[model samples]
Target: MDDVARLLKESWTLVEEHRDRLSGHFYARLFLLDPALRQLFPAEMTGQGDRILDAIVTAIQVVDDPESFEEYLRALGRDHRKYHVDAEHYATMGVALLDALRCTAGDGWNLTYDQAWRDAYGAISEKMLAGAAADGNPPFWHAEVLTHERYGQDTAVLTVRALQHPLPWRAGQYVSVEVPRHLPRVWRTYSVANAPNDDNVLEFHVRTPPGAGWVSGALVRRTKAGDLLRVAAPMGSMTVDRASERDILCVAGGVGLAPVKAMVEELTTWNRSRWVHVFYGARRAGDLYGLAGLRELMETHPWLSVTPACSEEPDFDGEHGDVSEVVARYGPWTNHDCYVSGSARMVRSTLRALAEDGVPPPHTRYDTFGDL
Candidate 1:
């Protein structure tokens, strides 16, 4: 392990138990340092507090291997553009973060820990700035909600158009969305559900979890036509492997099918021999709200096949039980390129199932909520 990694890991052990206090201290100290910075964050810090702690832990883990985390940091820096994050903000944040660590780590903190953290944060900030500077893309695009179609109990499909700007993105990539109504300046990740069109329009599939956050609830139950939103550049690596001639297998759970759907559409444009199969699952028949769209795609593209399954809905007409089981029945997919998406837990379980079904680890790709 690198010296910085060892120092970060050691300091993390000392402060991990105090994460709650650490996050609290961070915002308190941040605002104290620069009161004007408060406008960049959400009005309510309830859910945002947990996000801070999660971001720190994730950063530390990623920094454990500096070379491997370069792309992630770049993507993160680019995404922070939507939040109006500048180079100076990175320096201010580094100071507040180190102060929080010093307070939380108590007597275990020393000059060595301080120096190591400074070096690590410096490295991170430099890369993030480079990422933001590489693309001449604007910080955020102004978009108007063209349509919001609420379907089923808690699901909605949204289509929005960027105002006078081009938002270029690849299939299977997700973008962070910020709704001014719910929590101003706060953003949530949502997969773009369609291939880019000439009209500069983007589509999204939003599912409201049972006690969803403010942003999600507003999107599903409140956001309507004409509501304006800010969209960040698309980020996520769950894209189609266009160079490979191997067969493709995409597994998705619930709303996770958004990116998978995008990938399928991209495949249709290529007149190639590679076959693609999609296995999508939800809890009940009502939960399979997007089945019709998938069916429509399959009809248009003979090379693409879709299997919609419901685990708890006994009355459903389609395949019954876990979608993983349905996928396993068709396997040992050793040569297939597999892409999985969903919550952390769902992705974790599906990856294991694919592994057991003879899929090589390198052949499988999935995306996490890595919003930098």
Candidate 2:
């Protein structure tokens, strides 16, 4: 390894040694220094602190190679952008991190150690700031529930009126949600299902994931019209290229349709002439939401086509298999830009299948809806 990489690895080891102390001290220092940030964090600082520390530790562990590290750091920057974190907050976080390291490393934590990490953090934060600037500062969001419609048992679609001016975002972007007043305010990320337009209203198609947590369960069961919920601004790397003329192939599994729906809507609005093909995968007919609306959209747009794939369809006509199988039957997807959104495993599997079928990496994109 090179000198910088070696130094980063050494510093990362120190961070792990003092993980608990560093996490405790960092949050304590941040909240104590900036009482305003206290509102931004969950009421239960203990768990939140640990999570922050874990992210920091993981960030440092991968810092040896700047190229590989950039992805993680970029994701962190995006998450912070949702919170409207500025340069000052990043500096504060760096200070707290360095201080915690100094306390933990004791005699071993010298100026060299501090300088190495400070430099690393500076580079990372610079890239973050640049990215934010390019994207425009997304406001910390507050959602006003305008309308809620039950799709089926345990599933609902909410039309939220974002209180602040939202950032310019493409379809397939996601935002983090938190209920600050609630104890252990669980942070969860949900896809923005609305097309980017002047409507100034954001829509989310939310379903209770199996073994739902408190926040998600409550949102599905109890959240109602006029209820205000804390939302982070939009953040995600997955999006349709409005500028591209290539055919767009959207593959969605389960609730993965949310982002795909947004993209299709945007494409229609843009009058994109390239053929847009949608492959929707679901386990059963009941699992299929938005099918009728999508069919109507396809009928109205000559350039769009909708294909529904049901894995458990016993007596069905049309595509009755996995999404990959349907795609294969459609034949030669070589010229299309494919977007896949679903569980991580599903996304991975689909991407691999696409690659094996001759889709280049440049033409394939996916988003795994893992924890924020």
The candidate that wins on lDDT is 1
Worst 10 residues of 2 by lDDT: 177-186
Collision count of model 2: 0
Estimate the TM-score of every prediction: 0.92, 0.75
Weakest lDDT window of 10 consecutive positions for candidate 1: 363-372
- Model 1 scores a C-alpha lDDT of 0.84
Residues 271-349, model 2: lDDT tens digits: 6578998988877887788788899898889999999888898866668987777777785788999999876766777
The TM-score leader among the candidates is 1
Candidate 1 lDDT at 17 equals 89
TM-score of 2: 0.75
Q: After superposition, how far is residue 298 of candidate 2 from its true place, in Å?
A: 1.0
User: Please, what are the lDDT tens digits per residue for candidate 1 over residues 65-135?
Assistant: 66657877788889888878898899999999999999989998999999998998898899889999997
